[model samples]
Target: MSSGIMKRRPLKAADDKVHDFLTTGIGRVKALIRGSVKGFAKEHRPRSKNGRTAKAIFAEAQSPTDEDGNEIMIQVKKLSKIYGRRPEEALALLREGKDKGEVQSMTSNNVGLYDVSFDIRKGEMFVLMGLSGSGKSTLERCMNRLIEPTSGQVFIDGLDFTSLNDEDLRIARREKMSMVFQNFGLLPHRNVKDNVAYGLEIQGIPESERLERAVASIELVGLAGYGDRMPSDLSGGMKQRVGLARALATDPDILFMDEAFSALDPLIRGDMQDELIRIQSELGKTVIFVTHDLDEALKLGDRIALMKDGRIVQIGTAEEILQNPADEYVDRFVKEVDRSKILTANLFMRKPKNILYETQGPRTALRMMDNCDRDDMLVIDGEKRLIGMARSDGILRAMNAGDRDISGIVSDVPSVRPDTPMSEVVQIMVTTDFPIPVADDDGILLGMISPSAAAETLRNGGGE
Candidate 1:
C-alpha cells in the first residue's frame, strides 16, 4: 500500500517563531503585548507602581478619559469675567464725566471670558480650547492668574484664588503651579540646564541641589545628554522639552501648558505629544492645557472646554465630543476625524456561534466568516483538531484546480496564538498569500480572520 503522504512545513526553532511573530505579525498581538516576544525583548515593559500589573496600572493611569470623569479634578464655579469696552457713547460718557462719580473702569474692551464653570478630575488633563480671539488663552492665564482677571473669582485646589494677596499669590505660583508658554520663554543667554534650573535657583535652592534637580528634569524630558546646549542650539521640539523640564523641575501642584507644542512641525508635534503623554503617565500631574487646535484638544484633553466669545460652549472628552457634539461649531471642528485610531477592539469582537467548517464543504465556513466580519474561516476535521482554514482564495483555487485534486488546497494550518493584535494580523496578511490559520500555542484552530474584516469592524461604529 502507498504510504499516506502529508505535506509538512519545516519546524521552526523557538527564536524563529519569536522573530516571525514580531516582524510579520506584529498587529496580531499589538493589543496587550506590543510586538512579538523576540522583538519586545529589548522593550522594557513600562514599570508599574506597587508591584501592580501593567493592566491594573494602565486602568489607573490611562488619563482624563472623559468630561464627566474629568470634572472631579479641577473645579470652577460660575466663573465670570469680561474684557474690551462695551461701546461707550460720547454723550453717555460726557454725562458720566460731569458727575466725576463714574469710577473710570481701566479694564480693556476685550472680554476674556464670562461665567465659566466646570470641574476637572484628579489625574486628568483639562484642555481649554478656542479659536483666534476667542479668549481661551485669556481664560488659561486667568486660571493660573497669569493675566489677572478684571472681574470675577478663580479657585485652584480650593484655594480661593481671587482672594489671595500678591504675596500669597506669588507663593502659590512658586509652590503650586508651573506654566509653559507657546513661545517657550527660554532665557537666550542661559544654557538649557541653567534655564531649567532657573526656577529652583530663584527659590533659593543651594547650587548643588539646583544643579542635580535640573539634570534630573532634563532627563525626564528625554534630553538626557543635551544639558549644556543653549536655547539657540536646540530645535523647536527640544526647546519645548526644555520648557517641560523647567515646568516639571519646579515639582508644582499643577502643570499649565499654553500651546506648548504649537510651534513644532507636525511630526515633531506628534513626538512632543507622545512625550507629554509618557511624562503624564509617569508623573500623574494635574495638567491644565490651553490650545486652539481641536485635534490637539482631542489628542490630550481628559475633558475639553470649548470656548467661544469668552464663554465656555462645551466640555467633554474625545468620545463625547465626537459622539455627542454640542453644536454646529463643535460638529464642524471634528467633522473629518478618522475614528479608527481612537476606538479600539474592545468595542467589537464577538464570539462566533453555529460556525460550520466541514472539511469537504466551503459553504459553512464562508457563511460563518461573513457573519463574524472575519477575513478567513476556521477548518476542522472529525475530532475538531482545527485541521485547516476555508478561505475565499482557496475555494477559488480549488475550482481552478479542475479534475484531479481539490482537497489539499484549504488545509487548516498556521494559526496564530491568542492575544494577537489586529495590527499583527494585518502585517501577516500583507506578507503571506495563503489564508492565515490562527491557533493556540498547542496548534488548535480557533477560526480564521483577516485584516480587511478588522478594518470593516472599525468603520462600523467599532462593531457596536
Candidate 2:
C-alpha cells in the first residue's frame, strides 16, 4: 500500500473502536491519569534540568535578568485554535496559504486563532486587543489552555506549557498565573475574604495564612473593610475589586484579565482602569489584558497586539501604532484616537541645555544658567541622579550667603517619567513655574519637558 493510504486505512479502522472506548471508558482513563500522577508525585515531583521546581523556575523568571539573557516571560509560537471535528484538515488548509475565512469555507472549521505568535516580556503590561470575534480572547484563553489550541506551542518561563500533563498544568495554573474574568466570579455564598482566599484554599494553605493574605490583597485593591461583607452587598465596582483581589491574592507571576472592566459603568470602568495601572506600576507584574475598547487598551498596554480575522494585524506601542500604522486597516482603526492622550512626554522632551552638579558652587551654577539663557537648572548628584532644581535667584542668594555649593539652595521640583502621557505632562506644567524634569525610575535625569515644548506638541496635534 502507498504510505498515505496505509496511514488513512488504520485511522479509519480505529476510529470506530476509539469512539466506542471514549463513549464508555473515558472515565477510567481520567482515573488512571490521576492515579499515575499521584504515584509519580509520591516518587518525585517533576523538575527542570537545572533541578528547580516549577515554583522556583517561575519565581526566578520574575527577575530582571535571565541566565540565558532572555527576558521573555511568555512566548507563544504559531499558536492556532480551530473548532471543528476535522481540525487537522483545516490546519492543513491553513498551512497551504488559505486565510481563515477561506479555510473555514473549504473545511467548515471555525478558525479561532491562526498562526498567532507573540512574546510577553517580564513585568510588562501586554494587551491583546481587537473587536469581538477578532481572536483576542481566544488567544488569551489558548495561552492559559482554558481553550486548548489545535496546534502550536506556548512556553512560560522556558517551559513548554502546551506539553505539560494535567497535574503539571494544574500546578502551573495555581502557582504561576491567575485570571480575572468579565463576570465577577465571586461565590455568592462566600464572604469577600473567603472569595479572595479561594485559590489558596484550593492549594490546601493553612486557613490563618490564607485569610491574612486575603486581607492584605483586599487592602491592596482599596476594599479594605469590605472583606467581611458578602459579594451581593457590594456595588458593581466593588465586586470587581473583589475579583481582582482574588486573582492578586495568589501573587501569581502572570495576571490574565479578559475584559476585566467591561461590565462596569463607564465612570467605574475608568476608575478600575486607573486602579489597574496604579497596581501594575506598584507590583510590576506581567499582565496579559484583553479588551475590545481602544481607549482602555491604549491606556493600560505598554505594548499592544491588534488582532483581526484570527491573526495579529499589528503589534506596537500606542504612539507607534498611532503614528506609523502597519496597514490601511490599522490606520483606519486608529485614525480617530486622541493623539494628546496617546503621546508621551519623551516624544517632545528636549535634552537639558544646562545641568548643574551638586558639587558646583553658586557662581558656577549662575553662570551656566545665564549662558543657557535660562532661569532654572537641574541639579544632579555624583551618580547623575536628579537632586533638585536650582533657580538663578537661589544661586545669586547662595553666592552672597557664602554657601560652599548649590546643593543647599536647590529646591525640590516636580518630576515625571518619560513614559508619562503628554496630557498629564500639560497638567503638571500648568501647576509649576519651572519645566518638569523627566527622570527614569532610578531618578536619573533623562531630559526636561518645558512649557513651550508641551504646548507646541499639543498644538501640533502630537508632533512627529
Candidate 3:
C-alpha cells in the first residue's frame, strides 16, 4: 500500500502541474480574445461550398510553383479507397451521392478515403493530421500503395503509381520511398547495425557497401555507438532510432512517417521532434508525416492537411490555418495552440512608408517623415542595404550642426529577419521603438513590423 501510494502521489502531483500550466495558458489566450475576436470579425469572410481547395488557397503564398523548380513529388487526383466490396461497386455508390456510412451500410463497403486530391512538392515536410478514424492513416498508406488505392490516380515525379505492377511497385518502395511506423518495427533477432542494413541487403547490395551505409545511417540518427546493441537492450526511444536508421539506410528521396514520435514520453518525444527537424534541415528530403497532435503538426509541417471523415476539411500553413479557419471545427481545433511560437515575421510584416536613402539630406529625411505622419524613418544605402534609422529631431539637430547627409543623424535600430518567430519579436518590440526593420540575410530592408501589428497578429491569431 505504501509503494502504491508513492507512485500515485507523483502522478497526482504531475497532473496538478499540467493543470496549472494549462490554466495559465488559457488565461493568457482569453485575455487576447477581445483583440483577436475584433480582428477576426473584420477579416473573416464566408466561403461557398465550391470554394477553392486548401492547395489552391495557399499555392502561390505558401508553396512554390513549378517555375521555382518545386516539382510535385506526390500527386493524388480524385483518389478513393474502400474495403469489403469491389472498388467499382463502392465507387458507383459514392457517385450516386451516397455518403460513406450510407455506402457502407447499403453495399457492405467501408469508405476508407473519398475523392482526396493534393500535390506534395519535392523537399517539403507535408503533414497529414486528423483525429483517429479520420482516414489520415489510410491516405498515407494509399500514397505508397501499401494499401492499394481502390480508384483515382497517384503520380510520383509524374509517373503513375497506381498503374505499376507488383514488381515495379516493390522496386519503387525500395528505392524511392521509406516508411517509419509508430511501433519501432525492429527485428528482435538482429542487432541494430544488421537491422538498419536489412533494406540494403534486400536490394542485393554488397556486404561491404551495405555495412558502410548502415553505419552512416546509424550515426545520422544519433546512435553511432549503439550499432551492436540488441533491440531488447534498448529503450522505446532508442528502438525508434533504430527504425529511423533503417529508413535512412535506404537513402530514399521520400520518407513516410506514421505517428513516428507518438509512442515516446513527452520529453523524449520533444527531443525526437527536434532531431527530425535538424535532420530535415540538413538533408532536405521530402517527408509526409501523419499525426493527431495539432502542436506537433504545427511545429513540423511545412503545410498541413486536416482530414475529417475521410475528406480533407482544410489545408494550409500554420499561420493560414490559425488566421483563416475553414469552419467552426477548424477554429476550435486551433484554439489552444500557442500562437507566439508558430506565427513568424514573414506573415505579419508591414510596408515601410518613410525611408531615406544614404545620399539623401537630413532635410529630405525630415520631409519624408512628416509626409508619412511619423517621427522617424528607416535609412537605406544606394544598394538597398538597410543602414539604420533617422528620427526627425535627430535629423533636425544634425541639419542645424551643418550636416548634409542623413547618415550623420542615423541611429542603430533593432532589426529582425523575415523568418523570426513572434516569441523573440515580442521581446524586441518592448525594448525598441515602433516599426522594427525586417531585413533579409544580405541586410536589405524588406519591410517593417510595428508593436500594434505584432500585438494584433497575436491577439487576432495572425494576419496583416
For model 1, give the 10-residue run with minimal summed lDDT. Answer: 98-107
Which numbered prediction scores highest in TM-score against the true structure?
Answer: 2
My TM-score estimates for the predictions, one after another, are: 0.54, 0.61, 0.59
lDDT of 2 by residue, 1-464 (tens): 69999899889889988998897698688868977875655333233334434575455444333456748889899999999999999988888899988987898899999898988888889999988999999999999999999999998877788998876677788878999999988899999999999988866666667889999999999999998899999999999999999999989989999999999999999999999999999998999999988889899999999999899999999989888999987877776455544778898788876899999999888888878898988899999899998888889899999999998998998899888878788888888888899999999998998888988877977443
Query: Can you write out model 3's per-residue Cα lDDT over 299-378, one digit (the tens) per residue?
Result: 99999999987889999998898889998778877764445447788777888766889789877777777788999788
Model 2 root mean square deviation, Cα atoms: 23.6
Error of 2 at 259 (Å): 0.4
- Give the whole-model CA lDDT for all candidates, comma-separated: 0.68, 0.87, 0.84
For model 3, state the Cα shift of residue 10 in Å.
42
TM-score ranking, high to low:
2, 3, 1
Q: Which ranges in model 1 have alpha carbons more than 4 Å from their true place?
A: 1-73, 85-108, 336-464
Which of 1 and 3 is the better model by TM-score? 3
Q: Which stretches of candidate 2 lie over 4 Å from their true place?
A: 1-53, 56-70, 336-464
